[model samples]
Target: MAKYNDKELAETSKFLSFVLRHKPEAIGIVLDREGWADIDKLILCAQKAGKRLTRALLDIVVATSDKKRFSYSSDGTCIRAVQGHLTSQVAIGFIEKTPPQFLYHGTASRFLDEIKNKG
Candidate 1:
């Protein structure tokens, strides 16, 4: 799981919700509800909000977010938000393609291994 101090978590969550609910239109870039936002645009938004758009901050947020909230292509060249609440019981592979790598597994390796064997 992604680790963050209270401040960082709050900031990242706010940023995510802001983008998801309002889209980029509020900041002059027009984005459809389910569209990608470029790094430059994200930086711009952070700057506009008076947040420092440092590489460290960006990396922390991306690394720490739940995989269900976002996705990136195999090469890590493109990213988009996954639709819907993470807790909803839906098909595991609802997104177009399987993720290039697994992000998190809830419990210990022994448990995951048991699950894998059972399935």
Candidate 2:
């Protein structure tokens, strides 16, 4: 595996988040309704846009992200953000289910009073 430094990894992670979650059109690529993008097409488009990208770097980002923000297809040919999409085009398939007895939600400290009063 090719080694990547922190700067390379951070930059690539930001790039992936932008293209996969927000504006894929910025690179002239389209994500599927499920937000998956063809890895090869993404690489080409990003290169054309003056960004360096590769499968190895993508693998590193997906594997090392603390948030686990991206995932690969079953056959490893496609990739997508796990969540946090700002675009309305993606219809992420989420299953609705009854909440567990104990569920945790993370929020900023400023929201604590509002949550306590409203929740």
Candidate 3:
């Protein structure tokens, strides 16, 4: 296995996040409102970013990520971020079987209320 220093890891993580933020319309995967970009898109984006994205590299990054950064289907066709990593004040809904309609975070209610009152 290849080992990376702290700087390299941080750069890779940031790059991963950036790739996940955009959707690859060519591949027909749409990123959710939250920053969950598709896995295929991520690979392509990595390639564009000059990173040699391979199955092994992908597996290594996912395995070593401390924040649980990425999530993918068993088949590897679909991918997204695990959620809640982008913003400390936000909540992420990760229940694949039965996802919540609205994430129930303490700050969310207050934020929603403020939005509603403004409207």
Candidate 4:
């Protein structure tokens, strides 16, 4: 595994959140209703968006993220950020938790209210 410094990880995480969770259309990639995006398409779109998101980097990001932000599909052909959806497109299954102390932390500030209301 390649070692990534804190800054590199942060930048990559931010980029993934933007592309996977919030605005995949920003890079012309499509995320399904469950937030799954084709890994190959994600790479191509990210390159078009001027971001170098290699498969190796994606794996590293998914592995190293402290918050466990991203995930892969069962066949490993898809990827998605675990949270922070800007649209209703993603429907990640969420079970009710106790007290609601720990809940979704959205990517944008505008989503905070919606999360609070929905959760």
Model 4: pairs clashing at backbone N, Cα or C within 3 Å: none
**What tens-digit string does per-residue lDDT give for candidate 3 at 1-119?**
76666676677666566555433343343565544555667677667656766555666677788988886777776566665344332245545687679865455665887776885
Query: How much lDDT does each candidate structure score?
Result: 0.56, 0.93, 0.61, 0.84
| Candidate 3 structure, TM-score to reference | 0.49
Top candidate when judged by lDDT against the true structure = 2
What local lDDT score does residue 46 receive in model 4, on the 0 to 100 scale? 82
* Candidate 1 lDDT, 60-79, residue by residue in tens: 66667765566544665434
Clashing pairs in 3: none
TM-score per candidate, chains pooled: 0.51, 0.89, 0.49, 0.73
Model 1 whole-model lDDT (C-alpha atoms): 0.56
Q: What lDDT does model 2 reach?
A: 0.93
Which residue pairs in candidate 1 have backbone atoms (N, alpha carbon, C) closer than 3 angstroms, thus clashing?
none
Q: Considering TM-score, which of the candidate structures 2 and 3 is the better prediction for this target?
A: 2
Candidate 2 regions with alpha-carbon error over 4 angstroms? 106-111
Candidate 3 displacement at residue 106 in angstroms: 15
- TM-score order, best first, reads 2, 4, 1, 3
